[model samples]
Target: MTADSGILVLAGTPIGDVADAPPRLAVELASADVVAAEDTRRLRRLTQALGVQTSGRVVSYFEGNEAARTPELADALEAGSRVLLVTDAGMPSVSDPGYRLVAAAVERGVRVTAVPGPSAVLTALAVSGLPVDRFCFEGFLPRKAGERRSRLADVAAERRTLVYFEAPHRLDDTLAAMAEVFGAGRRAAVCRELTKTYEEVRRGGLGELAEWAAEGVRGEITVVVEGAPEQTVVLDAGEMVRRVRVREEAGERRKEAIAAVAAEAGLPKREVFDAVVAAKNAERSGA
Candidate 1:
């Protein structure tokens, strides 16, 4: 923490739009004694766009070489050279590289700081209609369906809004798994290419969004799902029937709908089925 020791700066970059880059990022990029970037070519492009000249020695520090590069960067920091870490987008060490270097610096007692910039996670959450007062960031799900579903199941009862990152190619499959594990009626938002020219935010129930993603999606993506109802919210018969009807309206069969609704509401399928039947019977009697 002494002035004799250099600082490790973790700088955030624009996720999509270059203009979103902050002034502090430009200053860090230009002033650091050593710059460790996830993508050196991308860093070059960034500095060119920002009209900032990086006078320091720029080196690649991606996942592949971060282990090998950490010690070298640590040596520089110990020698009183300010080291700046930047990823392709967003903050380094956030579902990205730079973790190794940061941990190494911390172990060596080197000070660490950050130049906060645009973040896709925060941007998506802010735009998502879902409640953000309490939320969990699940960076990405497993590539396999079974593992992904199991992961979703673990958070099935999570009461905080959930955010996730997904590849464009796997967006459809991920959304489908979410619909299955969380129920089709669960509300979510899919944010695509935030801050970009084609930025799009699609908010709807899981089933609807799954259908939309099935047609294919492109660009960077972040998904935010609404949390389960609070434990205090009573899932009465009428409410149970309403949930079942919502799933059915989204193309689920009545029997399948009943099971999903029951699971989400923490009730038995028999109870959901009875409630649905009674609601229908009452409607018929009224007619």
Candidate 2:
């Protein structure tokens, strides 16, 4: 907070286009006392592209060495050095390496700031033609089929638009899983190679997208999925009790059945529980 205090700058790099780099990024890159990059080679290429030469020491700070390098960067910051962190693409710590350094710097009272620039998440959402008013960035899904499906199931009922980053090779499988879990009729958009040559955005139902990806998709991929539709059906107490009893009869525990029925009815779990309880009490009184 003081004039002499060191600062940690999390610089956002272009996802695909170098020209999109912010002007402050070049200044920070050249003047920082230390530059910690996810990939030194990619940093070199970026500096060359921006026509800027780093006046400070450059160190590799990637997933493989993030833990080991964070403290070193924190030390530099504590010593009144201006440290700049840049990932291979997008903002640092966004499915990239920079979170540890930021946390370390913050814990040490070192200032942390960012140079805002292009973001693939925002870019894809902007172009996806989906509702962006309320959205969440899921980052990436788990690679394993079961884990991935489980992850999808967690948000199967999310009403806010969802965004995700996925690798090229796994696009087909991911899309297929999404289709199976999110429903084939669910609308989605797959953005590939944003701001670069061969950039493409395919929009369709999950089923159609899965088929398209089955043929193979190349380049960086971002997927935007439409949220679950608003529940409109009004379930009376009797209906709620009936649904829970059906699930319970199908072998689900009472608690889980009530929760599932509540979720499907868009009602509080307590409401469904009360309904079931009332129904049982009424039946016993009639007996």
Candidate 3:
């Protein structure tokens, strides 16, 4: 690990419109000692559009080469070289290759910073018309349908807005899977090619979005879905205990049964489990 190295800047690039590029982006591109770009050609075009000339050493740093290049980039940072990392679009390492290098640089005591710019996560969430006060960004789900559904099912009861990025080819399937797991009535917004000329954001229920994508979608996709609403129930402690015991007797694990009973009773798992244990003790005394 190198010491007292220069700063590692994780700069965000525009996802679509060139004019969306922040003023500081060009300056950083021009001044950094080394530019690790996901696509050097894209960086070249970006700098060209911004009318900035980069004299820095520009090298490819993408998924394929990120592992190999992280060490080199860290070394450059340790050597007091200003290494600016840029991805094709959005913040580097959000769902991109810069995380490895960023982690490496930080571990080596390199100063790490970012030029916060465009983000598909924030952009989609903002325009999705969903509850943005609290949200979670889930980069990309597994490509397989079964795995995707299982992943989404894990968050089916989440109360925070959910955000995800998907490629066009898999957009339809992903939306369908979301509909199945999160419910067809779940509200969501599909943002396509954000900030570009033909950019489109379709806001509707999961079922509608799935149908729309079935007609074929294009460009980068960002999907934001509204969170589940809170449930209300007034079941007594004895009933809660009996429910968990019933499920547990039916081959479900005690932990899972407890969670199921909690969800059914509209109470926290801990609260429900405590009640269940108390009920069990009372029943044992009676027996």
What is the C-alpha lDDT profile of model 2 across 1-287, one tens digit per residue?
55677999999999998999999999999999999998999999999999999999999999999999888888889889999999999999999899898889889888999999899999999999999999999998999987787677667668899999999999999999888767788999999999998899999999999999999889999999999778765899989988888988898678767766665665666888898899999999994
Top-down TM-score ranking:
2, 3, 1
Compared with the true structure, all predictions reach lDDT values of 0.88, 0.89, 0.86
TM per prediction: 0.81, 0.85, 0.83
Q: Candidate 1: TM-score?
A: 0.81
Give candidate 3's TM-score. Answer: 0.83
In the order shown, the candidates' Cα RMSDs to the true structure are 8.7, 3.6, 4.0
Best by TM-score: 2
- Give the per-residue lDDT digits (tens) of candidate 3, residues 20-105: 88888999999999999999999889998999999889999998998888888888888899999899999998998888987887
What tens-digit string does per-residue lDDT give for candidate 1 at 200-266? 9999999999999999999999999998765444689988988878888898767767766666766
lDDT of 3 at 201: 91
- Cα miss at 65, model 2 (Å)? 1.2
RMSD of 3: 4.0
Q: Residue 31 of candidate 2: its Cα lDDT? A: 99
